[model samples]
Target: MSIPAAFDYHPAQTVDEALSLLQQYGDDAKILAGGHSLIPAMKLRLAQPEHLVDIGRIQGLSYIKEEQDTIAIGALTTYTQIERSDLLQQYFPLMVECASIIADQQVRNRGTIGGSIAHADPAGDMPGVILALKGEIVVQGPGGKRTIAADDFILGAFETALEPDEIVIELRFARPPAHTGSAYQKLANQASHYAIVGSAVVLTLDANKTCTAASVVITGASMKTERSRAVEQALIGKQLDTATITDAASHAADELELVSDIHGSEEYRKQMASVIVRRTINSALERIS
Candidate 1:
């Protein structure tokens, strides 16, 4: 049986209490939210933090609200909540669509978006989608709160820009412009359900079906989720056609130093990157048309 190492558990009732515990424990402490990822690592001895500060009971941190031109989701919000939210479905269907396919129903009920993003696993699907949609991560610490763009939040595998004493508070996303559509496509490993190669695309088209803006992001094939500048450049000002998407998606791996693991070879992942990007782009275009 897999079992975790010895550790002191601190269940914080408020965000301030969580922050104070983190400050006291310093680097030896780990924040526990959903614990879907961290607990497994602990059992494997891959993570052996001396202290665990759990903030799952912090009230008012699991809401979804629309404010003017943006939607704000509390960090502790579960994947199940996002999947079931009528507001999220109406405004950002991409998020709801992606949430529906994450793991199984049980994991969805327990896994929080904040925990998933903070874990920063290379195979995570949300990071790529967030990058494509230009989401922001809001965090709070001893100095107060600040926001960082999705592109700058995840540094690498199992890493983030969050300071040791900081905790994620919420996620903010600007409402997409009119005539905009987005989609996420992924090839997943059968056992773990983690992405083998995933792509997310967001595009804004003018009346003539010419792309006014485009953002492409890919994951599971690199050290971190990365925006595809080459793909975006190829799509901007161009119509979404077979030839245009093919040309753009062909550059999916151009700027990435891809990951090679037992599940896939580097060359195989490179090929799938383009394939997923093309499919994702096609899906987004269909939604608007």
Candidate 2:
């Protein structure tokens, strides 16, 4: 295996210290969180940062808490924590479901939600779930902290709206309303376990079971994880049934420029998008009380 190029390492004890080191090192520095993504890229020599600012030692960056109407997750919280969180299972089980299927035991134990989203791999599971849940990414920079909606956070594959100096601090999602339900489904690559086609859906139904609101997001099939507005528009105000879901799922790839890769062809992914979206929406509908 190829080894990473020589680089300086800096361990940060606080967020401010990490920020300062980033500014000091400028473009030569890369923040090291869980190192699941960065280390592998480094090993392949795909990423050759001259300096690595290690924030793994930073205290108080890992937690899961409920605040009023929101669920707050610290940036450093690992996927394993999320997968096992009783609070998340009770409130937003889709997140737990999505987290549970990401990679395997060892990766989940070390891969962080923040780092995963920050890397913004189009195939990453959390981005689709966050988009469907309408979560907000809270980031801190040299100036201060700011929040970006998941809809606007991811720009494209391996890209985000975050500034070079910013550090993701927390992710926040509104507590789902009483009649709301959500689900995520994906066709994962065998070796890396990345999504080949993934769908995440959130639905809010009225007492009579008519869809009040809907959010449908697709990942891995495109250049970025994005909301399928066509699917969402088709579902809202309609009763979710076999016929309704089947028709709506047909639009899963509408307006999406599907990507063709070694894992699958664009045509195959388009077809699977519909299939996965149908299953995912059905799963969410079944979860609604």
Candidate 3:
């Protein structure tokens, strides 16, 4: 299908150039990173940006760096890059776990981290996974750079806290504490490239085999990927036992207003959320057990 005839395209070779175009076009222009999200939106006539500032050709933005306390992944890092990164595999296996289930090989080859976050699809997997780890997104705009917590950064489905002139630089996450393990599980729709529901669980176990801390973030619900505080509260300070897992999973939908489409109804999604939460928690506990 062809895009709307009224649209204009602007290819950019530098971040500065993209920012300049964004500033010039204001709400009339949309930034195009991988074109995975925007192209489809344009085709559906859901969005009609007068101009698109393309940043796909920009270089030196894709990298995975392991530092003293955290890992920094550049914005343009593709799902394939993340799924194949040995450094990520060694330290952040849950990220690789999530990345591997994203779409298919072809979409993974071109879709990017920044594009994913900025697209802010409520059903996207990375939002919940990164939120569970309490990651930060570094963004640069006319005012220079600043870091925003993942929770606060994603405002809603298909929306973010980014200004028109700003672009996400990278994502930073703390290295998992020793003996800690994590997992991501999702019920994906067939051939649609969207997660019906995705849950990321991070677990920390003490020397005596107790659950010291836990972060459970779930996406594809009513809101953007947000920590299930109720679930985390139930698990923290307890042993990662079957009883605890069952109890915590029940709290996964404490106050959420689930949305429904062709995939499921609100009630059906609520049930799946409980199932995915339990599965993620159990799967992660097994690794460190």
The candidate scoring highest on lDDT is: 2
Alpha-carbon runs more than 4 Å astray in model 3: none
The whole-model C-alpha lDDT of candidate 3 against the native structure comes to 0.87
Model 2, position 92, has a per-residue lDDT of 93
How do the residues 1-289 of candidate 3 rate in per-residue lDDT, one tens digit apiece? Answer: 5665478889889888888888899989998877787888888888888898888888878999988988999999999999999999988899999999888888889999989988888889887888888899999998889999988988877778988789998999988888788999888888776777778999999998888889898888666667889999999889877988999999898867688888889888899999999999999998774
Q: Give a tens-digit lDDT track for model 2, residues 18-67.
A: 99998999999999999988999999999999999999888998999999
Off by over 4 Å in 2: none
RMSD (Cα, Å) of model 3: 1.3
lDDT string for model 1 (1-289, tens) is 3788899999999999999999999999999999989999999988999999998989999999999999999999999999999998887888898888888898899899888888888888777777788999999999999999998998988888999999999999999888988898899999988899998889999999999999999989998888999999999999889999999999999998899999999999999999999999999998884
For each candidate, give its TM-score against the true structure: 0.98, 0.99, 0.96
**Which portions of model 1 show Cα errors greater than 4 Å?**
none
The residue pairs found clashing in candidate 2 are: none
Candidate 1 vs candidate 3: which has greater TM-score? 1
Query: Which of candidates 2 and 3 reaches a greater TM-score?
Result: 2
Report the error of model 2 at residue 12, Å: 0.7
Q: CA lDDT of each candidate?
A: 0.91, 0.94, 0.87
